[model samples]
Target: MDGTALLRWGRVCLDDLADRREEINALNVFPIADADTGTNLLATMRAAMAEVRTRGPVDALTTHDVAAAMARGATLGARGNSGIILSQVLRGIADAVRGGPLTALTLRDALRRASVLVRDALSEPIEGTILTVLDCAAASAASCRDASLADVALAAADGAAKALGDTPSQLGVLRAAGVVDAGARGLVVLLDALVSITLGEIPARPEYSPRASVAAQPVEDSGETGSAEPRFEVMYLLADTDADRIARLRARLAELGDSVVVVGDGEGRWSAHVHCADAGAAVEAGLAAGELSGIRIESFAQHGREMASGHPLAPVDSAGKLDGPADRGVLAVACGDDAAELFEEAGAVVLAGDDGVTAAELLAAIRAMPNREVLVLPNGALPAHDLVAVGVAARDAHRDVLLLPSASMVQGLAALAVHDRGRIAVDDAFAMSEAAATTRWGSLRAAGERALTMVGTCEVGDGLGLVGHEVVVIDHDVRAAGRTLLDRMLAFGGELVTLLMGAAARDGLAGELVAHIGESFPGVEVTVYSGGQHGDLVQIGVE
Candidate 1:
């Protein structure tokens, strides 16, 4: 198939699957009720689609490029167990078809290899799961002697469907619960959707009607209307860079506008999304030392009109216009709902962006609010660069803005806890930034690989304990790590210790950790609370 044709097929399949996500989500029977199989799959595919659309169509497009893009999307957008598995499946296919224009035989071999690769990637393969269904489907496809692409996909879908039906019977848990294997069923639906799309059957759009009544409409041509038409939406990736340079870049972007979203690591490679008028300037600014890829520019004026007419874009801007008292307004950029809620509770308006937010997006969010003056809190180290972009956008828009360099969530929370609401915006920003920086922050995260860290030699999947910017401990037991972290905090004469337990660690573990701290340090007060959950893990923040 041609490159454009392949992309079209992928997109159509994605749209079909997206339409039936709720049905796919309902199929979960095992691994408890908090299942996000369908949602995860959709998100993973959407990420790939975004990249595909950004790259557009090229005459000499190689399968390698397509596969590489898909793999990149999967890595970044992977969420749950099912999502990770699906990503691996795509990665395998990409690996198999690494050379060029795909023929029926190459495609079949890719599917066959992908099935095996997916199974190998999983630690334990269980029957009546997505893995089994995919394995059977691939076997069916491989056995066909003269199968075309359509024929292979149809056979694969058929095998998957049968496997899904038998899942309840194969697994005792599923039989007892009288429900099908959720993950397996979701995978079947995805494959079936792909087949249907290939056969020219398009699904209907899913309804998103909520139970709550709609609020009164704002005046159409009021002062708020112009703000809705943000001039531009900009996105780019930075090459090789450091934190100090990134910080300066952020300060520059901050002057642009309110809806800024700069996301990337400090190691020279970064991506940013911003909504502003001067997108050219924004792209030009990031061109220093790094080659920009995947640049996207959208006109919000046309976008807002489309939305008003019932064609809403993706839920990118959840934070509505900023208005009301300017004593302290928050400007935060984060991706997950749990993270956003954490900042919201700490008296800041949360803007959703993973890693970092662009200056244009930040400026747009700020300008959307009616407030004339505001304080920005970039909670991640990498996002600190966006503060500069926000400032630049703000100055161009003639808005007063103050940036509080709250480099991490811990610092942002601390600063919010002691914010002086009565002070001027500049004074409040500086004070909160300074206060947030002083609080000691540590995190317990799983090691991605077995390597020698600053703390010591650590194995993959081990719990890595970090104190501020330093590595302190690496172990397998989360509880033990928490205890060690608490002891270290107390050793620093820490009077008030707050343990923000992640969902995984929220099963009365925090109380136990607190008790351990209490026994170790008699005078200090320790508080335990939940930090919510995101993806497959929990986060416990200690202050």
Candidate 2:
């Protein structure tokens, strides 16, 4: 296949996985019942597709280039055990197509290489898991080497489906749970997506579900049939390491605990995962090997306890039940005193300062909070990687932290406006997230230097109006820029316009904008606040 075809395959895979993310998550009883297999897979695929899209235009890329990008992105973005294994599979396919087209023979070779690489990556490859399903697919692909690429993909998908169906018989955990292996089921979805792309039609597949006898059984505990599973799940990215050191790291992690997986991206970068009692030692072993980043250590014991109680939320204790009040806290990152006060008045624990809030500060703030469940609003100040790091660290410390994807301070306020302590944590989080997502946000800032933007050239002292990160309007007059921003934002249909005057905003700017909105877009309500935020002259949110 070509690069365009590969891109289509990635899109199809991502869409299919997105549709069945929660379903796949529900089948996660093996490894650990974190119920994030679907999330991990979706995240990994998204990272891959994102990288592919970044490689200039689709027409400019070759099959090898796209495959290599996929492998690299998957390696760097892989999460959990399943994501790591999936990375290896992508890497193998890339290797197979390095010097050839993705024909039936090369696809067969790709599957075979993937099986070997996956087995090697795992410290102890388990049956009835993704590994077994991959092996079955590879074998079937090998038998159809002389056929067309579509036929080979069909064989692979069929083999994976059969293996997934038999996973319960291979492992006691799945048998007890009366469900197919979650990771294997995810692989089948991927392979089916491949078949869809190759044949231009979706193949029929069995519904992935629990056996009839266990269909109604509640998941009280993780179906991990063992004396006692490891307490912690540690994962990290290791760089500047060699095969010898990776081997040693694997051996060391195996000594500490089980479920160890270390896979590389053909480059020096490697992703390591392990379930161990000594989380520190697991990380320390990687440190001895090379540099590390994205360090995440999760407690399975705490996770199990949480699962036993409920998936993500539970009823408050007797003292803080529906009749009584529960102390639900909101942690928001604000830029200045005005914004901080506004957040505090809205009942959020404000992390007020400059925009340079560190992960350490966020983690410390979360840990210091008395509430067990804390909602975090990063407010576009923190980077995505930093936000993820802080979330992992907070969870490691046993804090139930939910990071809302609020891109601006105004969006954070919009979310806070809908927060209700009376509702369950999950429902409250959903409501806040929905509010943040639906609000269209923009900002106005003075250009620091002359530069060419997506809109046009902007000189120093020019007012730049931006929606999200892209500058859409630039004008010499700040008020004109603000007017143009509102007009453009309102063109998309908004009933309410929320304006925050920044610390450096000119006097009467808010009133002028409100008047302009009233005259230009009648019936649109306007609310103004003194944000006192830095970097931007004004922040705007339309809902």
Per-prediction backbone clash count: 56, 0
lDDT of every predicted structure (CA atoms): 0.60, 0.85
For candidate 1, which ten residues in a row score worst on lDDT?
A: 215-224
Superposition TM-score, candidate 1 onto the true structure: 0.42
lDDT of 1 by residue, 407-481 (tens): 556666777877765555555677787777777777666677788878789887777677765668777876677
- lDDT, candidate 2, 394-508, per-residue tens: 6533447789999899999999999998876777889999999999999999999999999889999998999998999999998999999999999999999999889999898
- TM-scores of all models? 0.42, 0.58
For TM-score, the strongest prediction is 2
